[model samples]
Target: MIGVNDILSPGMIVAHPDRPDWGDGQVQSSIGSRITVNFREAGKQVIDGDRVALQLLSAD
Candidate 1:
């Protein structure tokens, strides 16, 4: 599970842990356990932080 410190904020860059096809993503929002990311290839998606730990690429 991702802690509050580990939680990413808006405009942060990230990548999917399991889906390379999803490509690079930009974090839209991180609220509680819900994270919204807009991917370069796969578009925007809402991820459950409790279930999948997203890899942070860079800060906003």
Candidate 2:
């Protein structure tokens, strides 16, 4: 199934829907359902696009 994360790409800023404490994160990479993000507080994290719909903060 298609998801919002399917539109995410590198350089985009996003926030974890569940982990607000993680702070805003930058899209490092997105391949298939795997998304790598570098958060201000959580550091690098691998998120499953199929599971978590990251909230878009900035397109650039």
Candidate 3:
């Protein structure tokens, strides 16, 4: 299980498990239980860190 302690930060890339429409997103901000991601397709979206398990994506 991913938690806030997993060390998420700005510029990190991630994918939403249930929101493919949003496409890949770059982490913009992480504060407490809220995470802001700027996606390719869906623009900026604020996700609940406690409720969503975001998949970390590699730049490679």
Candidate 4:
């Protein structure tokens, strides 16, 4: 399981299992291992917090 810290910067895309195939948005910020993302789905602000929905396109 990779975290925000593993990410380089925002605007990066990551696919979450529970979430949409494109829900993954740019990384807003990296708090320790927590990654805050600007979830934008059809111009809608989605809440992206813990439970980052494993099985996502993480940065390896």
Question: Best-fitting candidate, measured by TM-score?
Answer: 2
Best by lDDT: 2
Better of 2 and 4 by lDDT: 2
Listed in order, each prediction's TM-score against the native is 0.87, 0.94, 0.84, 0.46
The TM-score, computed over Cα atoms with residue i paired to residue i, of candidate 4 is 0.46
Model 4: residue 53 alpha-carbon error in angstroms: 6.4
Badly placed stretches (over 4 Å) of model 1 are 1-5
| lDDT tens readout by residue for model 1, 3-60 | 5326689988998889989999999988887899999999999988888788888886
lDDT of 4 by residue, 1-60 (tens): 764435445555554456574465655565554665655562323334465542335453
- Better model by lDDT: candidate 2 vs candidate 3: 2
- lDDT by residue (3-24, candidate 2, tens digit) is 6699999999999999999999
Superposed Cα RMSD, model 3: 2.4
Worst 10 residues of 4 by lDDT: 42-51
lDDT of 1 at 28: 90
